[model samples]
Target: MVKKIFYNSLFLTLLSLTSIVMAQKQYPINYFSSPLHIPLYLSGTFGELRNNHLHSGVDIRTQEKEGFIVYAPANGYVSRIKVSAWGFGNALYITHPNGYVTVYGHLKAFNPAIIAYLRKIQYEKESFEQDLAIPKYKIRIKKGDTIAVTGNTGGSEGPHLHYEIRDEKTEKPINPLLFGLKVEDTLLPIIQSIKIYTEDVLHDKVLEVKKKDHLFSLKSIDTLLVPAKFSLGIATYDVISNTTSKKGIYQLELYVDTLLYYQHTLETFSFTESRYINCLINYPDFIKTGVKYQQTKILPGNKLSLYNKHINNGWIELKDNLVHKLRYNVLDVNGNCSELVFYVKKDSSMQKIPLSPLPIIDSNLLISYNKIDTFCTEEVKVKFPAEALYEDILMKYASYPAPSKYYSKFHEIHNIYTPLHKNISLSIKTDTVADSLQSKLLIVRIKDDNSIIAEGGKYENGFIKTNINNFGKFAVLIDTIAPTIKPLNFKDKTNISKLKTLEIKITDNLSGITKYKATLNDKWILMEFDGKNNLLTYTIDNKILEGSNLLKVVVEDSRQNVSELSFELIKKVP
Candidate 1:
């Protein structure tokens, strides 16, 4: 047994060394200027832990409002311009000649020249969302040139600029701060709490941390008694000089008896590996307590590239009853660091206590992460892809009678605490309904708060099928209601050419809006759709006639429910 442990530790050490060498590549400093003219502060950090993914770039705060001029960082060509209702709403990508790419997202608007070019395409395509790739010679940019204006567009919660630097070839985002963009941060990271996991324990234990004289220690506990094999997790965050926002730490190192046992740095990571964040964090704890704890131990399927060093996958095994010193060092990108020291002793009387067996249900199935599997009940069927799960689990499932307003039984496939890496195909058998209403049938996930979220599905052979990434209570619900369209600025025949822009609000209660179109005098007009605000706006341009104009708008929901609004207005000015 001792020989096996030693060999495993040696193998891990070699792997760690190889990773360290791979991550030693130096970043060029001062090559790119700050995207904003004002002082830069962070609302979200690169590699920060987010829902089901790591934040790919830093979010630069915009003073809680929009319309700040965004400048080009360096000489580059506009490589890509993507405008959409969600996810980076108005994003611009610039590819430099030096094989690097800079991305600016969540912009309110692009400069006039770019807007003219983009509007031309939007009018041609008759679509509000577009992803266009510009030729290298078409739109060239120079350093410090005004490119865009910042806003809280897309999936952003507030006014901020999501900035990124990437390798042009690989398209993987690198930390923008590494390029010499600076933020004032002299404060060290705070160690909030720690969790100790033992091999023989069913539930891990959490301990709050207290600081004294610039060092952190466990509150009211000098030493902890644990079994032979154990691991650790920490809830830590950093703060900037002027902001109260808690940001992710840049680096974490764990030491056992003053020897480095594990370390991970927030450097560059691939987009494909971002979902592995579910494995890096204590997922169940996050779902339970809403606190994300970065676990020191690496899971079997966690292939994230952030770990630069580790020994035995960060599992420390005590061979004797001697008390061992454990230490954690957490640091921010500016090199401000905090240290926590504690002690643990191996329990000499410890024995392997067998874990209680999970309750055996007739429909329970063992799902493995390495292979695809399917589970079925009388009214429901689920197909899990090989990558859907992070580890093996004994799936617990149940079913209850259909609730009011539902067409199918309330099927409980699994608990929501466990996270899935990929979408799983789910098909639920529905009660007999009129064939005409089948088009309105869609699956809805019931949240813990009793709110229902639409998970659109298609009806096929008496079943409503959908692909879902979360596990929870789901049932078939019908949405026969069309979206509501309300004019915010002008109504039918009430405009006299004074309004600079026409605004309308479109919304749906159940199934979300899928498509919308606006036309003036039977010609397609460019109307920007903001899904977050459920508002569509069209700036009055040369497209409107001087005397009279007919405006028509059409919108549709996911269930094909349609809404239309038509109006006529006088435009006295050209």
Candidate 2:
């Protein structure tokens, strides 16, 4: 009794403290009229779609031009400056005293003041590609003060301002629209269709909606019964207020007979979980064809902590005459919500649904794979262990039974090691190939004539013997040689002074140069590599000494073969 009283009093005290924080510390919008003086149009609004993660910021349209002056939304100082090849070509981060960090990405160039500051450091470091983190006190700006100009840089699809605000402390991104930013949205969310899932797919029949175009109604359920063992996922998207375009849903709530089962609010999520978007949606189908289908499987392996926590959230057991009611509430950021409800009848004894005329799989064809970097295609088809792949965890295709044994020195099986038991040898059969074809095999291995360190052996149709193994780059033509450097003008033995710059033409026979480092007298010199030209050009920049120098150039391939050389030369100042 004493503990309960103590807890109640503490809760009330904390509640009073929370009320104070919600009032005085409001969003920072009092100073600036708008991030842009132009009619507030968004080329990409908050929570839009992207190739990977959901677009976190609102992209203010720049109206097709470079060098439109970008202003500071509030009084703040620069906290970070990062320049990269893919992400924000030129991005600036400013942290306000009121506790919010506004990020501006894909800028053409910083204002003169910021430019001078950045260039000085870049020259000091002698590198154009760099990330700079500076103290907030170093660079200050007032609201409406011009900070940079708009430009199509980095991975930007076009010229626009990719702006976002993150909590200074938590660093969690919040919807900028929540801060009273004016956006015209009034349309309600739209539901496309619903789907029912059962673990007894092999024994049960599926119920198809009799009609289309409108929400299907249920004929008063006399406690509709469905035998146990199944889950649910819906096919739906949200419709924004000002636009007719289809967008992702903001929130999802699952309830069983008015008792909440599961809920997930997109109000906040960490950036680390963003990669798990593959687990959140149908990753396999999404990769094959660029369409997203949200899966509602609540696999136990899923590590995301965003699921709504409640006793009844998203699970129902089958019982006789039990009417399982599932209510799904979908909402958009603008507060528009769409609800979907249905009754499940508890059927006696599990039964299989009739197979569709078209089978989901074909045992005849090999699943061709393709990629440039990162993942090596392990298998063509991946079947997860119930609710594993699409929703809870991204399952990788692993093969079994040592795949590399077929590779003999006389027989060219380039050191291929199939991914251990991780590879999936999907049993497929073909009539023409026959079971005898299993003896005929295609030997695959890591590139570069490397010996098979690990491998997998599998037979499809009892005839097609396939050797695949360990997940890694299969084609291993290791470029054991360094980039062949040819000076466009500088003769190896001759004095290299007829030129104002030293240009070393370099090329790797195989997996081209991944990195190159040059230095003069042990001091780092910036030499840019133009992959297209196969040239490493080092001009007589301001940093170069106007005297005798020893220049060293080293180039390495992706496989880590190094070719290095040093040149003794005298530089004459122009």
Candidate 3:
């Protein structure tokens, strides 16, 4: 009787869990409503390929204007608020009881009540940017409540509202379309071309595909054959009902001879696994031409969870002389599907392939996968963890002249076109920095666009060590220049009775600005920083007096170099 009871309990628990999962999947469609009052249009879609991560939220078009009223989609409380100069500037998070959370980002301003609350905390903290969490019931909000006003803030390039729905417990973003948010998308996906790769027992070859207007034709008479081992990749994009912009396809499926071989969908993904996009698309092609081609075949080191059902890792073996029919299905979020059909024939030339070459043993070299790999020379050392790379690659190294401001030689560890799955350890030995100024040294990456980005480093045992996410040109640079501050709206000691805001622009040469503070009459005041424009604006509040008000501003860089500006100002609200 006890054993039977135990089995019954286990079955009940599983049944309960299954029911919960089904409900979570269905709740958004039934309960949630659109956050905007107008008909919905999208500027960016969820699961789109970004620079380093998949776009976590959808960008809603706001008609190229700001200050549109943003409403709450469901009944929830304001659970969190983040104020920043970049990345979802002035964002809000609301959690509902339906096991989901809704996020509204790139807001210009919250409702008056929430703005007052934020300002009180900003004054207390004496900082413009803040991250705050509110307890439940503290800010009660119902469905359709006006939460914020939409604008092009933070990293946004234009006026739009960034919206997201997330799993409350897992914190993973759920595609909003999974809910009932209506987006008019009847057009099908456009498949530009399909690439076929031939892999032999010893070598791999990339085939050149012929391009036509819409469909790609593999020319030459049929019956052309290839190696028994082969893979496929496709370049495609989708169009919504009335938009010229091309977005990512929602689903992809591959079939060989009427049998389902592989499938992937963009329903949801965790941020931790988003970087695997570097392995999902053709990384080298993206680096060279900035085009993203989704590889239908799964690579050996790709661990993304997007692939649903795959057979033989999406590889096809043309063993017999049978003709293989290939069909690819691409779909958008709105259920618009497009299909491409092609054929592949077993080739007789594959029989003349040469035998595999013998491997050469090298004690100092290692091609690594699923194990840590290390390389060292007289002046440099690099350690790549097992998970650092999506696939095994021959470690390459070279050195060149550093840029003008750098103190060490530029190390070309590997081509930046190669994508790394995780951060790898890099250490460079140099004696250019004196012990007194070691704290100001940093490893910098020279980007293809000639922009310098700081890769934080520290001095240890006569070597500057850091962890880098990309394989690129790197060198040690010293940041001794302080930030530059220039007043924009007013001159020094000028009378400003009509002006309502004091605007200034601040910038740093290298190792970007770390901290900034503003003071009025030797007391703290709130100053808003806009990172995209490098502008700081301080509004005239009660904190400023009538005449001869002493205003001071101080800014610090990552290297602790400080810049200060003090001037007298007059403010009068006429």
RMSD of 2: 12.9
By summed lDDT, which 10 consecutive residues of candidate 3 come out lowest?
A: 206-215
Clashing pairs in 3: 225-347
lDDT of 3 by residue, 467-542 (tens): 9999888888888889999999998888888788999999999889989999989999988888999999988877
Residue 207 lDDT in candidate 1: 94
The C-alpha stretches of model 2 lying farther than 4 A from their native spots are 1-33, 41-54, 64-66, 200-227, 239-246, 284-291, 309-313, 318-325, 349-475, 480-513, 516-557, 560-574
Clashes of each: 0, 49, 1
Worst 10 residues of 2 by lDDT: 365-374
- Candidate 1's C-alpha runs over 4 A off are 1-23, 359-364
**Top lDDT model:** 1
TM agreement with the true structure for every prediction: 0.94, 0.60, 0.89
> Per-residue lDDT of 1-574 in model 1, one digit per residue for the tens?
9779557445543443454445556788878888998988899998988888999999999999999999998998899999989999999999988889999999999999799889889878888899999988599899999999999888889999999999998999988877889888888789999998777765368999998543688996979987788889999998888899889888888889868888898888999999999989989889999989999888776788999789998788999889898888887776666778899998766656788878766544788877889998778989998878888889988899976789999999889988898899999999899999999999999998999999999999999999999999999999999999999989888755788999999999999999999988998888888889999999887888888789999999999999999999788755
Best by TM-score: 1
lDDT: worst 10-residue window of model 1: 12-21
